[model samples]
Target chain A: MGGGGEVIDNKQVILKELVKGAPKESDMAVKTSSISLKVEEGSKGLVVKNLYLSVEPYVKLRMKKFEHPDFSSFTPGSAMDGFGVGKVVDSGHPEFQKGDLIWGIVGWEEYSVIKNPGSFFKIHHADVPLSYYRGILGMPGMTAWVGLHKVAAPKEGEYVYISGASGAVGQLTKLGFDDAFNYKEEKDLDAALKRCFPEGIDIYFENVGGKMLDAVLLNMRLNGRIAACGMSAEHNLEEPEGVQNLRIIIHKRIRMQGFVVFDYFPQYSEFLDDVLPKIREGKIVYLEHITEGLENAPAALAGSENVWKQVVSVSRE
Target chain B: MGGGGEVIDNKQVILKELVKGAPKESDMAVKTSSISLKVEEGSKGLVVKNLYLSVEPYVKLRMKKFEHPDFSSFTPGSAMDGFGVGKVVDSGHPEFQKGDLIWGIVGWEEYSVIKNPGSFFKIHHADVPLSYYRGILGMPGMTAWVGLHKVAAPKEGEYVYISGASGAVGQLTKLGFDDAFNYKEEKDLDAALKRCFPEGIDIYFENVGGKMLDAVLLNMRLNGRIAACGMSAEHNLEEPEGVQNLRIIIHKRIRMQGFVVFDYFPQYSEFLDDVLPKIREGKIVYLEHITEGLENAPAALAGSENVWKQVVSVSRE
Candidate 1:
């Protein structure tokens, strides 16, 4: 059925059970299974060998059982699904053929057979690292672009403050923002914001919520804009920390909006057109913390302090 | 330089000192003074006989020693300044004449000399109740219209929720909102919101913040909008209550904005053009709790349960 094709063993990181609070390595298990490198006849599907898998904070949310209509929880004993860069091994689909490089949502396994290949995006640029699709050139990059440009609508000379200034989203925000600070180092976030932005912040890219948000509210200038990108500080907590200074929203006339990356998927090509040149010009920089094996993916996803973007290299290629 | 020359005894409401928490009647004192119904020669000022004075919640904020640049605190032993309707007794300014009806920021006294008549709005419609200028046709009315139409931007069939649904801002919100309920009556605000908005709330006119806001955050629909008008609950509290469920904003893609009425002052004439007819046709109903005399003004401002728009009728027209 194929030219020099053979059966192979697939190594996958599976969710052992639903996690309650902060995810632990014990909640997941690495397993090995055998699969034929061939797509079934009369089926519109393609077999892919996953090269790199992304470990994002949002994936921890999917590890728990929740009634989210848009996202389903990872089933126990099944391989976790996440954003990944892959190579098409075999295809019965009209759009994709063998050896086509693609990136999108894929299983956290060495090889996966995707029934609906509609979600996949074909990789055209061979010069750029394929792993970039797992970080800066992928979802996180689009998130930062849409949030700052469309949502926050930042203007030059305006003061900007971003929490979690070393993360995937915050690093991207630093390129556009006037001044960026790492919230982790600050003893008092309010005092820190005051020192950085004495005139007050006009735009705030909210990544870490809780105390950071409370402090930012105190330093916001009139008609300030806050792009609520993520609440990583509250994600692991059983009860999210209370924000008390929300009344300042009225005093400052602030507009705070929360958005999802999926909503901006249609503008992906336009985003690429703008960002690719910036990348080539060295105007944009990306930092990634990569884990080599599927066995260590759970630790990578659980995250570490000072880590930028957590990425898992599923295969050597 | 007087039309009706007379030295009238002015009954004035003066602040005794700065208030700590919820205002008491004793915090303000009623004092009597004399003012000539005449404007000094060469001075660009006018003398007015106060008819009605508005008792708004924001007046309480000015009672304390807060350093608000735009609005100064009520100085001890001095007459409080607030929105009121009056008839011009004498004028030195080119725009004003004797017997002209006007409304704007005026002293909480029977008769006073207004140095700057520039901020005042002339009452063109003699048919409408002059007291309406202090409440519905004035500040509170503008607040509701701008918050709903401009901020929330509600569409037809979209669910709307309003906390403190019996106050000045809340009553006006009822006319435009599909359904309304008082936050005071509900033992569990989240359950009440669930009962009222089974499909989930699309727009929330936040009047009472703190715990009520926490509850509303739970019941918000995807892409929901929250018009943060006032935080009455937190105004009197020593330490404002904390809101814990803000992470729901990210999950639901919600937009929460806070604005001041002064920003929308330019649109006042446009607002009157739309709302005046609704009042004439009896399509809109307004409730006013009128408290007679400057002696009772402090009690009225302290706020009473089941009261809508509190107005101090200083002089019977």
Candidate 2:
């Protein structure tokens, strides 16, 4: 209920062990103790009460530092880091003010002191449920916006095929498929694609690019474009079904391109301009699978390993 | 060598038996016939003494009906087709007149009659070797130009890595890395990249993507762009070498995109204008591996199987 209570000091959850396989609940410990929850005066930082924590598939990528990409290795003794909607209790940066609710990189606990706090985004649209900040209004939204509109560039009546359609990015990607989904699975790929669009898909937003990519290749209209955003379905599997349909790239003259979100961040403002309105107008929708509580964060991400657009809600909100 | 008998009926080579495996000289046949060394009155199509044939690896792909893309496959029992430069014997089109020189897609015979041609650039610079049309002034030139200037968008002093460095596209791509290539490969991939760059590779034009890609990944500068035009190595190998360094794409935030010549054809004029001056000014070097004589066309291409930028010459200046 967000009821105010005496400030709890130095109380935190500590990760007691590094997880090997799917992380278990025993991997983390919640503690009650004594530490100041105040932001240092004059420092470019903000102390925030994390109101809603984000659970995402990428955090799993961080859990084990193998090589390729975004997040730092999680320290064994420290708390986990993620995106959350937080209310700033105090701020030293000019861009942030006390009581300003923002969304950005933060910790798994109830509160976090974030340096370079200016990087955090101040929530401007307060009308939407604040928890949406952890998802539809935040990172996941940015992912869909960047991948679909920017990378794929879907056109009206364009046959669009999105992998992970049931997940966060998938659902959001479908918002572009039709005003309503006539969504169905085709038993035979060609028939399925034909069923999806007898006219043939002009743009394929390839969030999944193994078997799904193969299917879409056959159904693609001449001069089709494929935006290779992710390979989530096979990321954990040892062998993704081989992409035999790559030959379609030549036959149908397809243009398949791959891009990571980080490469397009410079266009973030432009992306937001295009997406924020759609989001506000309900022209775009996002599907999020949320797991509750910070203690369940590891398990939630592990559980979400096979899914797309999964989220974790760690706070009261 | 410049002398030949007159009354010599024009001799030509044609694809005889479309093969399932590597092409054989017997797969192509030569025949001689007589034609008026003249043109039909009021014919717009130009006929010429075809001088040089630009042999490209893509031609091998075209020879086989099995499709992968960025190029069209040659029809069975037809003359092979590729980029060539020739002199006009007869001019029927307004775009050309007697003795007017042109270069572009033409048949794989001694002399070809081209109709409804696109951008048959008038050879205004005779001082430049006409054979240049098969290489720098021709189709491969445009592919490299579009992939580099348009796709890769390379910057000066940025480390640029070109796989198949000895080939037509590779030579030009490495030329893009001009003056930046150092002699050593460094241990720290980034530093190794810097050694090649000391300035950092802003662009990578990827013609080969197995070990070469693995090596290029180490040398890629932050936010480097890759123009993934071809993967000849993997295209032929039953089992392509695993690229373990793919994670580098995420780490360096690199951008790798692929292309086909036909897709960029609409931009042909823009390409010529943007790149022609560079050619005229000697800012760019054009390389061609040419095989002489129509009878030797198959062997010309076959000889360069393991080599780069090798071309089979059908005719010459």
- In terms of TM-score, the best-performing candidate is 1
* Tens-digit lDDT string for candidate 2 (B43-130): 5566667777766666665666554534556676667777777788776677677788778767777777676556566666667767
Per-residue lDDT, model 2, residue B14, is 67
* Per-model fnat list: 0.80, 0.11
**Residue B20 miss distance in model 1 (angstroms):** 3.5
DockQ, all candidates in order: 0.67, 0.21
Over 4 Å off, model 2: A1-13, A40-44, A92-95, A171-200, A209-317, B1-8, B36-46, B68-81, B115-121, B170-200, B230-234, B237-251, B262-299, B305-317
lDDT of 2 by residue, A77-146 (tens): 7777777888987676788888898998788777777878756778877876677776766766666677
Candidate 1 structure quality by residue, lDDT tens digits, A183-299? 667788889888888999898888878888999898999999998865243354465788888888986899999988778888988888888887787788767778898878878
lDDT of 1 by residue, B1-317 (tens): 24446777888999999988777888998999888888876778899999999887667777887655367788999999888999998899999998999999999899878999988888888798889997788877888888889999999888888776676566575565556566667799889888888899999888778898899989999999999865243354457788888877887899999988878888989989988999898888887878898788988887655334788998987
Shift of residue B147 alpha carbon in model 2, Å: 2.1
Task: Tell me the lDDT of candidate 2.
Answer: 0.63
**Model 2 — TM-score against the truth?**
0.79
